[model samples]
Target chain A: MKSNNSFRYFLIFAGAGIYQWAFWHETPGLNISIFTAFIVPTLLFLYPESVKKVPFWLVLTGLLSASLAIVVHASLFATIMYVISIILFVGFAHWSQTKSPVFAIPSSIANLVLTPYTFFAFKNYVATNNKKSSVFLKWVKLFVLPVVILIVFFTIFYNASDKFAEYSDKVLFPIQDFIYNLFGNITFASIFFFVHGILLITWILIRNKNTNLSDAEKNQTVNITRNKVRRKRHFQFLGLKREYLSAFILLVLINLLVLAANIVDIVFIWFGFEFKEGMNLKQFVHEGTYLLILSILLSMGILLYIFRKNQNFYSKGKILKVLSFAWIFQNLILAISVGVRNYHYMEYYGLAYKRVGVCIFLILVFFGLITFFIKIMQKKSSYFLLKFNSWAMYLLLIISSLFSWDTIITKYNIKHCKELDYEFLVHMSTKALPFVDINKLSTDLSYKNPWIINSNYNYDYFYVFSMRNYYVKQVFNFLYDWETDKFLSWSYYDKLAYQNFMSNPELVKSYKIYKDYRIKKNQIENGNKNSVQNRTPALHSDESR
Target chain B: METKIQFKTELLHYILMNPVRSEQSGRVVFSEQFAIILKIITS
Candidate 1:
């Protein structure tokens, strides 16, 4: 038992050490950080002894998926994937120890929220009773006192004699410099992060061990009791056949109204009807998409409420069910109509992140409506629907995260579109900057609108100066501004993009020439204007002559 | 009852629902108290 405890402590220490190294180095990016974080806890606490088979495989797959996401530029998609992986990691970790997937969500949340308290409690308990810890404390005290005394005596001796002081300074200068360099780089934030990592690992191990032991003890004791009879209250609303009939009628009415709207969309949008005087693509697309989403959600809520529990056993339930299904089907058509509108808008104004988000949201709503239909047809419980939809969302988010959307958007606009939004492209993040053909843009704009070149020059100067200042000065001016902290905060992708921009010597030279030309022109114009403003009558007459 | 009233009451009931734990002793300590205890121990 003592050895096992010692091993656990060693693993915790090792994990903290790795965390400190990664926090400073910032080489491998987010993947290494997340992998180490998840793996450390799993290995120390919920490993082979406690982890179940299914959850183990699920967590492993999630880790790999997150790793793949990191490789793909850490865009929004990758962020979503990372978030899902964390959820799955937490869920599976809980399931492994308890052999029950029911409390997975709450248990995971508790584990995260209660980590500090768990660490404190465990440390307090161990310090009170553990002989090894007591001995370690004693040794530390012994060692620290002697070191203090020696340092004091040496200081006194050095102060007493100039010769002794010089000799000691010569001997210790290099060592002093080394120690200063080492301690100078360590900051409060790094120490806090190191302590957090150790606490998290310790919390997971102790919490899981205690939970497993308690569960085992619970299994050993079996209590047998006779079931008690309960009184049945009169449910006055249950026998309301008229209410069901009226609800069915209302559902049909709502469905017909939705169907009429869908028909209009099919005719006007799908068949390419010309817009009215003030009707623009933006208005048409933005207005209907959100309404469609809200309507679908509202329809699902109504269906769930009407068919909940034993209400499904109503005599007129079949009629209501048919009407509900028809309404859901109409909602699906509405989702498709919204998608068509979004596509048209994208065609006119070009694709953007929000438009793409609308498409993904529509797809999810379509799946949700389909699941609602299934829930109704199979008479499944609400829990069944909840679990099914949760898993579906998880899968959708994972798949979505795999795509590098910025690269996709940049490539598509550049290759397929006739005219590119150059300003938009320039404003895009470092990931998308490489795909933009700035040379072609520069030539085209220089011929058409030469003034744009001046503006572009200004934009580039401001962008570079601000980015450099942000990464170098403002970021490093914090309280815990260690080398590792600075490195971790710096965006390597941006650095690479800046390097790529500077690689084009011709572009840089052209920008410099254009700046000089603008400066000279401005100076000449200012000189002439000033002369005109301050001119005397004789000077004005001479100028005229 | 009208449908609106019934819906409102149901929503209220759900909002008011609380978990019932059988073993009060097993409840996790609040973080503030835990921190205070830690401070005492270290001091």
Candidate 2:
């Protein structure tokens, strides 16, 4: 008994010690001081089953002072460490079924201050905006993004950090990194997931495929689906037992939503944008996360409505049905709209022109659809369905592979490249043109007496031209039919500008006029804009290798 | 009969007290001191 007692203490102490040592090496200065002070006390306080006898509040105050010693410069790491400690405490609380842990209040307050700072850092640095006004305002979408990212990264640590560092360093640096990564790209993927879940619930309705039943039977089926009950014998969370089946279904829906949203974003980005706000299905789904949070309020509303209408069976039933159906219907509408838009994109891009293959695919699909409908109507399916499904999946995989191969081949060839006629590129980004000698641009050119000027050292030609000014502005406008008076980075295509002028000698007259104007003024105001207007041919090929 | 009850209690306590051995695979598999203590009392 004594040996076991000693062993348990030894493991915790040893593990905690190793974690602390690793942290000391990784963290510098004030972080080290505060961590060193807090580690021993945290272990001591947390170790006891009951600190009520030993003045827990006084001990917490001491812990708080020590934690506060952690410097702001080390805020990123310290904040993360604090968050991890909070999470650990949460786990402890869960296990013990008590929230009265050592330094609970002080630690909570410290985290409330520190966590927001980490979020703000990400916003100011990564998100790159000047929109912040108050401390609270700074902790908006931008703040949430980073904190979420941090949580994800911490949750999934590599073997090197989790296993090796756990014993050697008592600090939670890996956890901090995890949090930063989570907030980094939550909007695009996270929102999609939320919407995808709602859509999936609706999709289950669409995919039900039990069409042969009479209206009463259909209604019965719908009722069965709607009033689906799940029973659980033993499992519990938050002191409440859940229906295991319902929980599982909800989890599945959540996972599907995440996957679908991610896929939508990926697919939309892969194809060029022709949408308002350049938002894909992924972004739309992200907007749905804001909607899902409304579920709590909606649930409350549903409960109240049920209480109010408990006497009227029809009203109560209708209210419940509407509450359940609303999410599904909204999700279905979103999915259908996005799917149509995707088809429209396919048509516009001349991908639909290659419809011979698609026609054959449609014929095969027609047969499959007929068979599926017939089976559902007759309530009859073959035993060989599993085998058939496997074969069909394999065939689909092959077809998909072939399609990808064709697309890849087509992607590389200049024959399929979108034509950017010379006039458009010349009008967009002359700043990217190599007409200005790199040597002269990089250094100030003093041809006349003693006037000195700063040289143009914008080496980021690719971003300034193709990505920002050229493709984003002019091309997007032409594609989407959206009018924006302001020109953006995508408008420029220097290659097109050069091609337009090169076809005829008459184009040089505009260049000559610009040259004469420059000679007379000795400087051109908005030279970049003017140069784009009277664009020259690109020095190299337009198609990027 | 007394010995059997004590043995059963010790077994129950051991099962509850010990950290599941399967989880602590590669790293040093230190025997759980707490479980051993609980076991001793029941024994």
Candidate 3:
């Protein structure tokens, strides 16, 4: 309380408590935009020394990502971007102070999580500069663990036995009442938010005074050095000339192989192959997916090997360089080939998480090959390749989050898919529920007729029908859960979905019917299972019908 | 004719091969029954 920076510390702590009370008291919103607003300013204003040393573009990008959270519809993607932005900015900021680049992310993350501990355990002199604070720490050290254990035991007993809970309530009611009156109805969730806020600010302020990872990457240079050849005891096989020849030959071979594969894909898959309804599409594109992955990995390996040293400096290196560029170009086509393969697969089978993941992976490969091209032209070291590709990955990840993939998969599959995997569609998110509702499907004639959509999959018609009912039940349950979760654990898309469901009269009517159907269906089926005589008649009559 | 087949198949198969709900809902029932028993015992 009496340190030189005691008031500043108090202000930081009070800011956390007030922020928790204001925007966070319930489930804390997990709203990264709001969080970023608090964090960026607090760190800048209070601990300018730490955040300001980062380059202008880096800081601007961090701020832009933080601000994007406010502009974009809140999603898991925005949240991840916000977190990674913070981590990168802080990590780089901390790493910059150490004069390093490539390994900043890991070390800075370590700093972010462990800062409060580091601050309290070693740097407590900044906080507890008074004699009374030492006494307080001693008291806390002796009592906190036992008090925590007691509280845990009490909670377990209270939950396990109603008698014990009632007895404890009777004894503790007056004290609880007194505490409630004194604190104006405090909750564990609120306390957690308050503590989290303090920890976040602590991370912003006192993070990684000692940089570990940046030091490791401090001397990481971009240029690949050419060492003068010193003959090592007749090991002529280890010569750079031989290495260049071998890499050139390998590239020439792979280039021809990949070009041939790409030609087949372009001719058949891109322009010629047609999707039939009953094809085993699950196996058709399955092997193609792995081939694309292996090709991409192999291309990277080829580039890394050929460009490992001064092979690019040889007299006949022009042809090798041509071969390398040609190889990268062919690999880019191979990436496009997978994109087409995925499209064909989705055309028949349907768009789901797997197909979308392939699309994203293709984008990553495209960036990687492009970076490889750059690495060859610039003679950039392996670390530059790592660094540039990671940046590309960061951008791609943020962009990918902009769309609600679940709803897109659902709507897209329903609109265009030749065959529907009913089980998987049933298991999809509530965001796509209305799109698949049987009543809605009937009204919306643009889509194929209900049977036609889910038909070609090799399952019993009855099984698919029951699945439709189950899907309806799922939607109803989701809306019910949304109603209860109005303010608690708020998500933008979920809330928007709730509003849309409530406003649509047809959807509401359908929900009610589905709910009623599930109850009746359960009762009738249970009764049939219990009655042996009835079961015999029902089976016989079903056959007769 | 297709609609009739679908309806008949749905009616029969739904009863015969409904998903095993009891495997999941059995846990829910046990917890609910436990709560009731606990209430009675405590009272």
Find the candidate with the highest TM-score and give its number.
3
Please give fnat for model 1. 0.00
Model 3 lDDT at residue A133: 44
Give model 1's TM-score versus the native structure. 0.64
How far residue A260's Cα lies from its native spot in candidate 2, in Å, is: 24
Model 1: per-residue Cα lDDT over A176-261, one tens digit each: 99786545556686678788878755654544322322243234221222224554777645444766776777898898899899
Model 3 earns a TM-score of 0.66
Q: Kindly report the docking quality category of candidate 1.
A: incorrect
User: Per-residue alpha-carbon lDDT of model 3 for A1-545, expressed as tens digits?
Assistant: 22334444565686675556445423223344455566666556544455555352464465465446424344444555666766666665444453332465677678767867854553442334454445545776999999999999999999999999999999999998877654654568667867887777666555555546755675777777776776568544556677877877788888888888888989998899986768777776778789778878977886887777667567668788888899889888888888888887777677777778788888899889888888888788888888777767776776675676667777888888766655566555565555664432221113222432355422334343345444444556566455433253456666676787778775565454433434544444354332211121100000000
lDDT, candidate 2, A1-545, per-residue tens = 11122232333344444333333113232434443354434434434432343333333333343234233222222233444343333223212222222223233333333433432242332222233324344456668889999867765664437574575345656666666554333455455543443332121111111211123222221111122245574865321122323433453564466457546744664355455655464444334433533443353243223222112233224333333333333333333334444354443333321232333333343344333333323332332222233334333422332222222222332233253222222232222222211111111111211111122212112122211222212222222211211121121222333444344443233233323332322222223232322222222112111
Indicate the residue-level lDDT of A1 in model 2: 11
DockQ of 3: 0.07
Which ranking of candidates, highest TM-score first? 3, 1, 2
- RMSD of candidate 1 to the true fold? 20.7
Tell me which of candidates 2 and 3 scores higher on lDDT.
3
TM-score of chain A of each: 0.68, 0.20, 0.68
lDDT for model 1 comes to: 0.55
| Residue clash pairs of candidate 1 | A77-A401
